[model samples]
Target: MSFHEGGPRAAQQKDTRSPGTGAGTVALFTLATIMCLLALAATYYFFVRTTTGQFIDESALVRADTIRGRAGRASTEFLDWLPVTSLVIAAVVVLFVTIVRRRWTAAGIAVAACMLANLATQLLKDWLPVRPYRGVQTLELNSLPSGHTTLAASAAAAVFLMVSPRWRPLAGFLGGTFAVASGVSTLINQWHRPADVIAAFLVVAAVMLPAGWLVLRTGKDWNAWDGDGGHWASSRFWVLLPGIAVVVSAAVAAYALRELILGMEVTDSTSSYFWAGAAMIVGTGHFAMVAAVWLFSWAARRRGPARR
Candidate 1:
């Protein structure tokens, strides 16, 4: 059965979807939440407190500092707009999905996710101990779990949660693109290292994945669909694209990192590490978005639909 895109009905108070024990969604929520925390912890350990991680991170920053003049100014200017832009976009998305769709509970969950993720970024960035001096010339301040990347990613995640399942594939693709682009912009502007941005994506996912389950549970009626039997543009192509892009970009990143590992001519700012950093930014961010989609889909399927 197809759920018509209409205004809030009395029926929406009770989700049309089955009210199973929700054991599957609960399990998924647990795993996804754990993964988020794991991602943050692993990133902090490897990138913030370790020597090897500092080398790669600082090297990427050093490379980013190479672009001089107009190009550099433009990138920084663009990145400067990201935080505000992300918030605005997220606000608009939430407003439309809530006001137009009248999905009060879903809207609430999505906004809460966005706010929680960004709040986590601030807490981790400031409350966490500073990146210890590892003999690296980089800044000593804490920058892991970048605030800017969190802003972009969480905003995108909010939109992903607000949209319907049929639209999630496309929403996920576009949202991932915006998020990865924001992370890359931070890299190009030398605002954040690769690990910091990656940590941000992970943090957002950690907060949002559980929130997504909440959205599914509360708004079960409107959340289910008969699957996407729509246009190609709205198909799994969008869903698969991010995973494919991450794989390809990861391959590219590994090749570049190998050049550095082999002690090839990777010392200068002109080395392949720049591309490696960018690829890491893209891969990690998209991977998180894909996982978000998968989590929501899993939650929906697990709950199944109730008889009307």
Candidate 2:
């Protein structure tokens, strides 16, 4: 008797993934989330509680005045534009990707994470204690995890989540640049200190890492793609370039710190401290983006055909 082989064969082919498909992804993301939280706490402890940290932070703010000019006005304009820009990025990217790819669950998770990150920032701002007397002249108010920086970074992360793995590297890099620029703009405008911006980066990372893990798990079909070089956006350069930026910025920041430590005759009007703060923001934002790219790439399955 001839038997039709289509039914069982099709069923077998329907699912090739094992039960423990994304366990490693989950564990890695959990560890990353913990790291982000710990980094945020350390930021607060160092920049808010310690005397030397307070001095460095306040010095950056003071040095900001020395750069006030056309550049400052440009930064002010960018700051004014930040809220609208953030909303537009999230709304447009999420809606377009969702409608096109029909990624309803991914979109929902991303939007939710973005909102949660922003809300968490506001809550932290209000609930955190006032900067206590650390024997350094500085603002007494609490401004950890800057509101604008949180909004910008989380919005970028939302876009990163909506895109397929093939496009994530490019998206992550561009989004990182935008977030870093927003953070630096806040500093250039003297609206928030460097620590606040870095804290915002950590907050977005902590919130989005789990959301990314969920995306990889649920959207496994779309998440899998050919390994890097399949597309220009998927190229390793996207990650490597950001890593290079982190290294260069770190070096600049280190030089600035060394100068300060050696008791160099650096005046308040000098731009060294401001540059150092900007470098720190650039390094931190890009580092977070790079980490996200690496973590998601690791979790996402490679060399798989799209499953219906």
Candidate 3:
């Protein structure tokens, strides 16, 4: 008999189907565009006017000093590493999807989306006349959208696209956290203004959402393909535990290293311990939820047989 004979087969077939251009994609793109426009307006209003420019520059300098004082040298260095790490993580995610799941088209789409976003950001930066604060020069060009923010947003979007739906919430949480942290760090480091970071994020999202929709419509089962059905498989339950452990451990170690080895003080008050505790609880709860779902499914299947 064919695999389609079973009830499970029908459900599986339906589950594997792709979603078309939905309201979510449309809304996301629309919002992104609005944000980009708003960012542009903000940049012009604040930077072009002399009085507004002075206020913004003063504010930026104050904010930069606050962040620098709070985070110190180690945090500054760590923030500097964010762009590199984001790129590496995005590359690794795409490589895993292609190599393990054999989803070449999806992987290609991810790469293309990232490249397009990066290229768009660079082009916008070059074309725009927004300038940075220079003591002698008054204003310097080529500082519209921050490249670090663009890279962070693009990388997060790529990772979100490649992961399974079951893990999407966690992926989103982590991705958003990383993006915000990166943007804030850039602003605090005096590398870019608030408007620049906002513009970069909006542009990246604008490119990625449509790209995600196109990838999804291409008949790829992004979620169903378990990663080789091994211990390292991309199950939501398994991923949460290990992913949290790794993130928490890394954060704690970095904090410790900064304090002891580098003689740097973290004045954030809420250090690695707070984050670690939160991660552990959230991860454990998510795992429990997945276990409950599996149990419910199994129970329903068993009851059906007995009724028959």
Candidate 4:
């Protein structure tokens, strides 16, 4: 066959091989799902079951009390606004995309998974045993998998799911920032421990990863797009910003921890623990979103000439 004729045929063959249907994609997503679950379990065990972990967790909450003048009220207000904000944003984005692109099945799956993530958070909160007394003078109530964080993250995940691949990096970064802000607000408001916020992230990842796999499988045609930098939203800035945030947040947390271990006075309204917990929240949330961006970017089809 002539080179021109063979080119079109080869392109047709490549297009038929949907991006997310490969064995490698399945293994990667499955590994991610399992990792989230294990992380959730580990967060619960360390924070709720161990003495040192409980001490640090409770200390962070206690330190948050020192900064309760203006920041606390603002955080409380933000938490109060979270439900309405999440619902409106999720509904608007999902509906607009579904209508614009006629992505009915993908939208349905995203919305359903979003709901399930939220419900699972509530169930885990109730079903998980109360925090064991590990010589920490704290409340006995069970607050793992923060409800507010779950709502925010799941809503963000829904929006992330509905957008085309070119828009996902931007969407993921923004969504992750929203989730991190919600988690930090909960901490500043003294509503949950760091582990609770972290668990919520895991819960969202656990549910959304599988839902995303289904999205790729069902919406193969619509998922194709030029690789990163082909559009403004697909630029590397989105991923880079989050990666930088993760690094900065990790440094902050490490410094705070080192101060604590070196016998520095951290309990005299220093708020060091609070800052560390907030950093943890920011780092975990951004890392999760970054992973989502990378995963879906790999899974989505890039329209290009077929490889020889």
Top lDDT: which candidate number? Answer: 4
The lowest-lDDT stretch of 10 consecutive residues in candidate 4 is 299-308
Superposed model 3: Cα runs more than 4 Å off: 1-12, 15-17, 21-58, 131-142, 223-308
TM-score of 4: 0.93
lDDT by candidate, in order shown: 0.77, 0.86, 0.55, 0.88
TM-score for each candidate, following the candidate numbering: 0.87, 0.91, 0.60, 0.93
* Number of the top-ranking candidate, with TM-score as the measure: 4
Which pairs, if any, clash in model 3?
Answer: none
lDDT of 4 by residue, 18-69 (tens): 6668999999999999999999999999999998678778888888888787
* Winner of 2 and 4 under TM-score: 4
Could you give the candidate ranking by lDDT, starting with the highest?
4, 2, 1, 3
Residue-wise lDDT of candidate 2 within 1-308, one digit each (tens)? 33444565454446556311556656777888999999999999999999878878888877888888998999899989999998998899899999988999999999999999999999999999989997888889999989999999999999998898878899999999999999998888889999999999999999998888777766866776557877888899999999999999999998878766787765666678888899999999999999888777766543253332
Question: Which of the predicted structures, 2 or 3, would earn the higher TM-score when compared with the native?
Answer: 2
lDDT, residue 183, candidate 2: 94
| TM-score of model 2 vs. true structure | 0.91
Model 1, TM vs. native: 0.87
Q: What's every prediction's RMSD, in angstroms?
A: 5.2, 3.8, 11.4, 2.9
User: Compared with the true structure, what per-residue lDDT tens digits does model 1 show for residues 155-189?
Assistant: 88899888776667778888889989888888888
